[model samples]
Every structure is written in C-alpha cells, then in structure tokens.
Target: MNRNASRILAALFGVLAVTLPFFAGDYPLQVARNIMMYMALAITWDMLLRSGQISFGIAGLFGIGAYSAILSVIRAGMPAWFSILFAAIFSGVVAFVIGFLILRLRAMYFSIVTLALGEIFRIIIHNLHDFTGGPEGVVIQKGVIFGGNANSLYWLVLAGLAVALAASFWFEKSKIHFALTAIRNNEISAQSSGIDIFRWLLLAFVVTSAIQGLLGGIFVQSYGFATPDAVFSADFTLLPLAMALLGGVYSTTGPIFGAILLGLASEWLKLKIPYGHLVVYGIIIVIVILFMPQGLRQLVRRTSHSADGRSA
Candidate 1:
C-alpha cells in the first residue's frame, strides 16, 4: 500500500477508536478493549516469529508481568503506573536470560523448551503461596493507572496497543527486518553475510516478551484480580497463535485482521455455546490453517488480483 492509503486508513481507525466509546455501552467498549489487547499481543508474537523463532513462552512472560505488577503494588506499595514499568523491565530481563538457553535450539525443540519454560514459571508462581497467593492468585484491589473504571482501563489498553503497533512498524522499517528475513531464509548464509543471527533473535525474543508482560499487567489491572491459572492459561498462548496464523503469520496486518475477527467470534461464541466455544475456536483454527495457510490477507490479495484480471 501507498503512504497516502496507509495514512488514510490510520486516520479512519483513529477516528473509529475515539468514537467507539461514544457509540457503544460500557460492555461493548470492554469487548473492544479485549480485542485490541489480543490484537497487539498477536502482532508482537508474529514479530518474533518473523525471525524463524517459534516461542511458546508468552504465558510465562505474561504471568511474570502480572505477578511483578501485583507484587509491586502489594509489597512495595508502588503506584500502578510505576509497577507496570517494573513489570515490563522484569519480563524483559527474564526473557533476556531465557533467550540465551533456548535460542540455540531450532524449530520444534525450541518451541518445546519455551513451552516447558512457561509451565515452569507457572508452577513456580503456583508454589509461592505467600507472595503470589499460590494457585489462588492475587487481588489487585485497585484499577489501572487511574483508580477504578472501564473507560480508564480502555484507554490504558489503547495506549499499550499503540506502543506495540508502533514498535512492530518500526521493526518492519528498520534493519531488524533484514536481520530477521536473513535469519529466516538461511542462518548460515546470514552469518556469512555478517548478520548476528543469535543476537538479533535474542533481541526479538526479549522485545516480544516485554510487550507480552505489559499486556498482562494491563489485563490483571483491568479485572482487579489475577490467578495463576487465568494468567498462565493456554488461552493466552493459543488465542494469539491462532489469531496470527489465521490472519497471516508473517505480516503485521494479518494478525490485526485475524484478532478482530476471531476476538469477536470468540466473544459471541462464549455467549452462545458457553461450554463448547473453544471447540469452535479450534475448528476455525484448523479450517484456516488447512485452507488458507497464508491467512485471510492472502485470500483477499488473491481475490483482488482475480477481480483486476477480469476487469482488464
């Protein structure tokens, strides 16, 4: 797309975001916030995947952020805003440490290690009864940066989405893109060409982990409570993975589109099926992967091309 088209689309989205609260009630606004949050997470996850790394530790980083924010509030008596910053930093540090160990593995081995790491983090938190409230989790007792309210939480989530989106866009335009593409295409060749594959991969991992942590902080604060199972649930990992895969794994826009579509569907399905909604989600994921592996973005591109050809 051209810069003009991009600017126009962004302006339209901005207008819609600003006007959303005005048109929708509190419940709908809350749903919009959830959708945007997951969209941001999905995009960040895809960003790391761009470098040919498959990370399954999103829940681990997210849980770390949640616990960090909660503990900062309860133990340190810090302000909510400051705690969020601390949570992001803490998650990034953990990611930096963990990246070194797992970045050496490739494909399924790396994925399994990350998944195990997530479980390890969850079990550790679960065992820390005094600090984390064990499996019971912690009660936040306050709202987000403000105090307590839906609109405040909505704006907080919007800010997070904005930051994540901007970072992803910057990565696409910077040398990170070349580094990631090189790493993805051929690590040996990339290294021969002087690309620090390990360094770039580690950087991507840490950055994505920090964003996941930030989102977790927002999520826990928004709900005014946190639980080990809730924060470290497979839902967080599976939903974002499905969203990215469904929309288009490698492109930024793909996850946004997929998240919006699947987020809404998942919400509605919960009300309709209550118990089996997740089954529907799994089915959707399977269908998308089987039929449109390149994602809805590719489907749309193909349709546009066919239409243009017919017109010509």
Candidate 2:
C-alpha cells in the first residue's frame, strides 16, 4: 500500500478501535479485550521472530507476569497498577538472565530449550503450594481497576496493544530492523558485518518477554484470578503462535489481523466444541504452514496487486 493509503487505513482502524465500546455491549467489549491481548502477544512474538528466534516460552513469561502482579498485590500490599510494573520488571530480569544463557543456541536447539523452560516454569509455580497457592490457585482480594467497569477494562487492554504496536513500529523504523533482518538471514554474516549478534538477540528476547509479561499482568488484573493451569497453559503459547503465523510472521499488521479473525473464532469454537477447540487451532497451524506459509497479509497484498494491475 502507498503511504497515503496506509495512513488513511490506520486512522480508520484507530477510530474504530477507540469508539468500539461506545456501540458494543459488555460481552463484546470483553471479547475485544481478549483479542487485543492476543494481538499484543502476536506483535511481541513477531518482534523476536524478526531476530530469527522461535520461542515457545510465551506462556512461561506471561504466567510469570501474571503471578508477579498477583503476588505483589497479595504479598507486598501493592496496588494493581504498580503490580503491572512489578510484573514487567520481574519478567524482564528473568528474560535477561535466560537470554544470556540460551540466546547462544541456534535453530531447533534454542526452541527446544525455550519449550522445556516453559514447562519447567509451570511445574515450579505449580509446586510452590505455599507461595503460589498450588493447584487451587488464588483470587484477588482487592477491588478491580476502573471500579470494575467493563468499558474501562476494554480501554485498558486496548492501551496495552497500542504500546505493543508502537514498539513494533519502532523496531521497523530504528536500526534494530536491519540488524535483526541480518541476524535472521545469516547470523554469522550479521556478526561479520559488525552487528552485535548477542546484544540484538538479547534485546529482542528481553523486550518481547517484558511485553508478554505485561499482558499477563493485565489478564490477572482484569479477571482477578490466576492459576498455574490457566495462566501457563499451552494455549497461551500456541494461540499467539498460530495467530502470528496465520496473520504472517515478522509483521505487526499481520498479527493484528490474524488475532481479529482467530480470536473471534476461538471464542465461538470454545462454545461449540470446548473439548476440541485446541484441535482446531492445531489444524489451523498445520494448514497455514502447509498452504499459506506467507499468511493472510501476503495473500491480501497479492490480491490488491492484481486489482491494481487490472485497473492500470
């Protein structure tokens, strides 16, 4: 799309997103909050993917954030808003430490370690019965933010997504973009060309982890509960991964669009086949990998190109 078209479309979407709650009911607003959360996750995942890292630890970091917020409020007597900062900080620190150790590994090795680490995280949280409330989990003792208003909660999640979107656009505009593309295409070449491979990789990992963690913070704050099974579920990782793939990896808009479609489908699927919705997600991943590897974004571009060609 041309710059003018892109600007217009962005404005249109922005207006729609901002005014949506005005027209929609509480349920739709709640559904929107979930979609926005995944949209943020998809964008964060895309950031790391741009650096050529396939991390399956979204749930691990996100759950950490969720628990961080929960613990800060319950144990430390902190406010919910401050707990969000605590969540981000705790997750960022963990990401920083882990990135130093695991970022050196490449390809499937890195992915495997990340996947294992996520399970390990869940296990540890599950076992911490005294501290984390174990299998039963804990509920919020405090009141909700915005006085528990649905519209307020909806805007809050939207604000989080906007931050993620800004971070994504920054990655594209800054020098980080070229550095990551270089690392992705050929890390050795990127290193040879004077890119600090470890630095960029660590930066990407830490930033994405922080974002995912903050989203988890929002989740727990919105719902007033957190559990090992619920927060650290495989669904968190797989759903975001599927959304990113379906929308197209390495692009912000792709994930946003993908989340919009899949997020709604997921809610419906949960009602229709609660026991098998994840199977549908698995099937979607398979289909996207096999048939539309470039995802919906590329397909949209192609269709647009064809229309433009015919017009000319």
Global lDDT scores for all candidate models: 0.85, 0.89
| Local accuracy of candidate 1 as per-residue lDDT tens digits, 1-312 | 433654686678778877887678888998899899889889888999999888887888888998888888877898888788888898999999988988999999999998998899999989989988999888866544566676777888998898788889988999999999999999999999999888999899999999999888888777767889999988888888989998888877878878888999989998999968889879988998899988877777677667667431
Candidate 2 residues lying further than 4 Å off, grouped into runs, are 1-7, 310-312
Error of 2 at 267 (Å): 2.5
In model 1, the Cα lDDT at residue 278 comes to: 89
Output the number of the lDDT-best candidate.
Answer: 2
Residue-level lDDT tens digits of model 2 in 1-312: 644765687688788889999999988888888888988998999999998899989999999999999988988888898898789888999999999999999999999999988888889988999999998888887767767889989988997898789999999899999999999999778988999999999999998999888888988988888999999988789888999999888888788879988999999999999969889999999999998897987777777778788532
Q: Each model's TM-score, in the order given?
A: 0.94, 0.94
Model 1, residue 142: what's the lDDT?
Answer: 55
C-alpha lDDT (0 to 100) for residue 114 of candidate 1: 88
**Residue 94 CA error for candidate 2 (Å)?**
0.4
